[model samples]
Target: MNVELRYLRALVAVVDAETFTDAAIELGTSQAAVSRSIAALEQALGLRILQRTTRSFTPTPVGERIIAHARRVLDELALLERVAGDHGSELRVGYAWSALGRRTIALQRQWEELHPDVSLVWVQSNAPSGGLADGSADVAVRRRPLTEGRFTSTPIGAEARFAALAASDTLARRRVLRMADFAGRTIAVDRRTGTTSEELWPEESRPAGFRPVQGVDEWLTLISTGQALGMSSEATAAQNPRPGVAYRPVRDAPPIEVFLACWRDDPSPLVADFIRLARAAYLPG
Candidate 1:
């Protein structure tokens, strides 16, 4: 039950090499050490696993069965190590709403093909810093400039802004909408996670009032019921399409800048690489 893998390995080497001296040479150990390893293996298991004569080394019937089982166990343990190693090397990326939208799958696939040593995992948190503020994520895909001093960020790409409207709203009929058109409407705003603010409009043209929401679900739900109009990075339109809401281009609005955020100090080793890979992923197609 407590046998060592090295002991089992030594036994297999002796069988395959046909002699303890040969196995010792292959293993870069002295013949006495190989002999001791096989003896220790037998003693640990309370069984004689080898039939040895002066000039011949063979396996007893039980030795044959144990050897097969040892090979299987070693192979399975090697596989387990790989699975564990992959999980340890994983990078967890947090986001509030959309994770690169249309680019998400491509990013994953390309990162895998280019660097198979690490894996990426996505977690969603509705905070403006994504999950970076909490311990839920190691790095994040954020749309706004992160003001938190604990984090540093780099711009990856910019996505056009879009207005989220009730499907039945008049603006939905327009091929493209403008900031002026949203005047006089209630704005559903997620101050923590979203990039939109009344500052995007002139003081006189801002929405009538702001209805605060904690997350995208509430923002979308309120928009669906025509309770408010909202704006988000273009990725949100592609990543989350509500059944009762429509997305229209905010032609005059400034594009939302997407950023890769990480701890200002002691960031993960993978963070910079992830940022580079992400920037490349969003390159114009």
Candidate 2:
């Protein structure tokens, strides 16, 4: 039939209240209006749904069957509304390990204050590949500039690699070191996981006899033992400079660029707000 939801709601209210006046009060309408709605609903369905006397209203056998199904439909509509509202209000943010420093955390706090309606979730990854491709995250902070055409990126900041060595190491005496200084040195490199090509020294260019370490923690241990030196981003160097470790800038090395990346198709307001905060926090005046 062509009956609308309002008609069904009116029918249920009338059946529950057992009087047109009471149903009108429940539906926020006049008694006459409620009666007209019921009459129209009956005409559309080609069945008398209610039995009415001056003192009372009662549901017919056909009306009882329809009311059961109508209640189910109304419940489903309420659930659909809630699901849509939740999906519209939530956002997932992703970042590389080096990207989640004090500054980025502060930016997240500021963004939340400004957009209280949107929920911000933080995700961390070591890979340069942004998480949007796999849907693990909605927005990402990538250390290496994104080459994937599917994502939209904004330059956040520039990062650089620094050599970390034991203070007793000979290279530690220099104010800064060049890539060539690493020649003949037993260098520790992260080879176990998330090693992007840019983070690696080309096989031909790497120091002869350099050893690859399997984990970040293992690399740190190797460096601490005074047996090997390792390279890390400036942010990581700043955070974890041990007593025996010296951090020096790596001169003549290509700079690592950081970007805020998001799916090209995501139209979430929360993502937009976070991007705005990141630009303000990282961009130079």
Candidate 3:
């Protein structure tokens, strides 16, 4: 079967955007073009890749495998283009949310001073692997480590947990909070990319309810609106300071461990250097 790169791109865009209309907007093409690409791809593969319903679009089992490979291929193709075009060396570091919080700039500056020949690029992606699995980044910084064997992870540093509440909530007055303090509140979480989970608390005293959100913005919105509270790493507290939302240290909660990860078979040469600098950046001066 002759499968083109545009077909793969269309497949990924549709999946990421969750609809052909949105995928078209993302790809700068018409909705009909996106639809045709998907159909052409399916015809070439001779199998159903996506399950579409009135409410949602999701990948079939086989489509999931195909999409994963597609991401890797597209990533490699991008690298090839950069090399062929003589683009200078760059290390793309991906993160789902804040990249090292307040230390992001310090790390970037240090990297530039040490390796002026190579540009340090930060790519923000909402993927669970922080863009590694999707091939958007050469390396990734994550609070939740990837379990896939194809990936290798290194521990960089840990940050204390924090509680996020509506500024007007009575609990917002506290200077610090404990895990138990959240037991009575509804907790908002981004199950895909966020570090927090209901399991953090003892089963019996867990939050009143766990509401899953799509991303950090949604999580913060829920907290800020008094619809729910949230738990996250100190990095989040430092990186995102939304109005109507108050962040307080969760004194008794366990610290959130940070990790640097990359594909094991084709790891970036700068991964080690990046890890060393990241660790130093996270250090208390």
Which one wins by lDDT: 2 or 3? 3
Model 3 poorest 10 in a row by lDDT = 79-88
Clashing pairs in 2: none
Residue 35, model 3: Cα distance from true site in angstroms: 7.3
Local lDDT at 171 for model 1 = 86
TM-score of each: 0.67, 0.55, 0.80
lDDT of each: 0.80, 0.68, 0.83
Model 3: per-residue Cα lDDT over 1-285, one tens digit each? 989999998898787666786567556579999889999999999999999888788899999999999877876775664344234578889887678988888899999998899899999877666776445677888897788776888888999998999999999888998888887789998776788887899876688899988678889988989999999988899999999999999888999999998777664457778899998877887
lDDT winner:
3
Model 2 TM-score on a 0 to 1 scale: 0.55
Error of 1 at 43 (Å): 58
Index of the highest-TM-score prediction: 3
Give candidate 1 misplaced runs (Cα > 4 Å): 1-87
RMSD (Cα, Å) of model 3: 4.2
* Best-to-worst TM-score order: 3, 1, 2
How far residue 111's Cα lies from its native spot in candidate 3, in Å, is 0.9
